[model samples]
Target: MFEPRLALASLSGEADAEWARAGADWAGAAVLGGVCLDRSTREAARAMVADRDRSEFLPDDPITFVDDQLAALSGVDLRPGINVRSTTAEPVREVAAVAADHDAFVEINAHCRQDELCAAGAGESLLREPERLEALVAAAATGADVSVKVRTELDGVDLVAVARRVEAAGADAMHVDAMDSEARVADVADATDLFLIANNGVRGRESVREYLEYGADAVSVGRPSDDPAVLDRVGDAVAEWFAEEQSPREVEP
Candidate 1:
């Protein structure tokens, strides 16, 4: 069995630095900065360029954040955000440019619940329009590694179909916001063979185990480090799990 990988869901470049200081092992792991599509948010993020403030703040611009994250976490791989709307093509190009420039992976954002994002034809709302979603993935995949982030819903839209369409559109991976259910994860895993990174409400080792069993290729965690001890414990748990799995089986006497 392959050892599971862990990624820190960084809200900004500063948050990425904090995760590194918190003893996160970044080798072969990813550091994903949140979506940075808004104007004001972009301005603030730009001001914080090279500024290492660990204080809480909003998400940073995907481009700028990815650049800094690549430098800060040199050994780790970078996956930047790319929250695009259903109709627009401008943001698609911008996100693709950033991904190419930084030599980083681009993740299409469809999991954010912000009202402005939804009203602007972005975020989870994009999941409702399969054709548009396919187009966005197609356009994004043209430049770099493109992954789509989607939330699992009970009714509204058909997520399985969406996953298949995204995979067919040449997306390198699928970031499934499972919210809190292994069944939803299994649904996504069953729908496509694309690399799946399970997110949302993943708090500890047990939750990670459940996601892995459901066929997740990786897991992302956020805010669990609010308690330093919890961060250490989680890291140890992950390392222990990998160590034990890597150990060879004992031979019979």
Candidate 2:
């Protein structure tokens, strides 16, 4: 029903059907699951079927995997966002089409720091390779809204430049995980017009409001969102804040 001023960032295997359903009404937008299209997810899925110990946090169905979750979200009028990992533009349009079909948002997984993902030239590896990220965002359908998730403070990476590049490459929004320096969110927002979701270490509504004040369009809770109560508190806080900001003011005659 809304564009998710209060949101839940992607949390691999933990973010799924039951979790999505539990926080359905609380999170204006919820990333259904993490879908990685790379050597890592491929290995994980294969290992999953072989009963081996692996990440076990990947999309098996890839294309239609989140359809059920998206359907459940649609039942509640919540917007669905799918966080995905890939090393190439080969599947960007296909994935974008799936998200567009459901009116959901396709978020590029440039935030993951897994070793295997980086080895495969996906995830944070994209931070070092801006050209590839540009190709992926460019491959997204023109009308499909795309979000690029990236980590800040990586060695040798110009985060501000990365944000500007993604925005220029057609990413409508950015999910910024300011691992150690939360100021990077505002820095990026101040430097560009990209709608930003301030992420990392967000504990409550106060942090949410802080990020919003710093220029984020929204704030996202990841690990803490596993508990439904957190979403409840943040949702309630956002409602109160929204009212205050929208309330009428007396004219200064």
Across 68-137, the per-residue lDDT of candidate 1 in tens digits comes to 6555655443333333333455556566776667565667767656554566666777788778778778
Taken over the whole model, the C-alpha lDDT of each candidate is 0.62, 0.76
Any idea what lDDT model 2 has?
Answer: 0.76
lDDT of 2 by residue, 1-253 (tens): 2454877888866777677667767777787667765565566445444574544455556766656656666676567788878776766677787778778888888877766667777788898999998888887736378888899879899988988898898988898888868778888888998888888877777777877777887778898877777877777767776787789987999
Residue pair clashes in candidate 2: none
Clashes of 1: 0
List the candidate 1 regions with Cα displacement exceeding 4 Å. Answer: 1-4, 10-23, 26-31, 38-72, 75-87, 225-228, 239-253
Kindly report the root-mean-square deviation of model 2 from the true structure over all alpha carbons.
2.7
Backbone clashes in model 1, listed as residue pairs: none
